[model samples]
Target: MEFDEERVALYETILDELSPPDGEAVSSAHFEKELELENAYQAIEDLIRLGELEIVNTNCGHVRVRLQKPVPSSTPSTRLEDFSENTVWLAYIVSGSSPRQRRAQRLFQNFEVGEEHLANISHTDSLAQVPGLEDVWCEEVKGLSTEYAILRKEYVFEQADDPWP
Candidate 1:
């Protein structure tokens, strides 16, 4: 399903605030402070389905929630080759188990991975050039057994003029 800009922004915001003490099932009032009822609810549902967020329990008037942080097998360093108002670069680390095959498949499909994707993987000695077809870049760090491979990718974006700038 396609997400509108607001929904995406909301998801990001929620994720950012998803630290340990943030109760799982927050009151509707608290959520309304950060997002409209419909948007907050939808974002929660999406996050839960993605396994990034989970509900622990519901109390008298609140819900307990947990936010799962992404763990990387390797640390990545970012370098800015060139910077301009029109260009931006990024790098990210990614990791998962072999049992997460379905998640990996979904990721590859969404990121436009194809035979060329495998070529990129083969060329890079380190799994750092996994080819992020999306605006985001990620890389693999290490392989855990034969079941899972940790990867990372870098992102380069051609930016546009900032209307506000």
Candidate 2:
């Protein structure tokens, strides 16, 4: 998977809100640990430089940071078209016992053979019918797709051989 700095910043910002409601700051180490990132220091520094985070304090090489902007909580849309106009790919992780199954969200847009970017996602709603869904994440990568119709569960990440000829 490619490193998307903006998405990482958004994820970190959301995590910051998980800190105690007593106005406590979130530590940079927590972000690194939670995300299992190798270059967390650089990532955090980039976010700070981008003004998404502020170094509230530093103790023993660890830094406590604050989100520069307020993050508003959003309820998942019941209707697919109700999603924000920027939603490019709807992603999620399959529910399973493994940590990766529950933690990592694969960009499962379900495009058919020969299909590519700017997809038709009429079949996206069918994912709700499939079992063991951890959660749905709407990703805004530049813009939304063309709402092309396709099947369920297939994704670009997997190099699986298509059974259908």
Candidate 3:
């Protein structure tokens, strides 16, 4: 649990440069090129645990990252649950998933990548909310990259022919 300075810098750059000043939801995939598949998930997870970042599932079909603002009037957002549904961004799944799901998964539901969902999950978590339907999401969903997938859907799902392997 030593200080991860690199992770810290990654989060900082993400907030300062990638996310717009308007507080719009930005794609977490912005860090994909900068992070190795092994590190991207952990970087995001650590930032979340340290109360420095939030990964939100946009109901409009993508995963987003929003930085915690420090303005005196801004209420600090330590986790996804703390965010109210702001119409400025696409819809957030923070209000959709249960509390337990928030702890277990990074993103929720099938989301758009370049053209559609699973188009580019490299260096990011896949959409795996419920237990039983993971196989369906894994199998039915096409265009997933094998290199950087972090599957955390834990609902005792039947196995499917994993594209990641």
Among all candidates shown, the one with the greatest lDDT: 1
lDDT of 2 by residue, 1-165 (tens): 113655565445544554322235677687678856566666555444333456779897778876543332332321221223222333332221221222222243343221232123222333221111112222222224322121223212224322111
Question: Any residue pairs clashing in model 3, and if so which?
Answer: 61-112, 131-155
Q: Give the range where candidate 3 is weakest over 10 consecutive residues by summed lDDT.
A: 87-96
TM-score of 2: 0.33
On TM-score, the stronger of 1 and 3 is 1
Put down candidate 1 lDDT per residue, 1-165, tens digits, no spaces: 125576667667766565433234454345656555456755665545434555666576544555532322122322222333222232222223321132332223223443235334433233232121123333333344322222222222435412111
C-alpha local distance difference test of each model: 0.39, 0.38, 0.35
Candidate 1 regions exceeding 4 Å error are 20-29, 33-38, 59-62, 70-165
lDDT score of residue 80 within candidate 2:
22
Predicted model with the maximum TM-score: 1
CA shift of 125, model 3, Å: 33
List TM-scores for all candidates, in order.
0.36, 0.33, 0.34
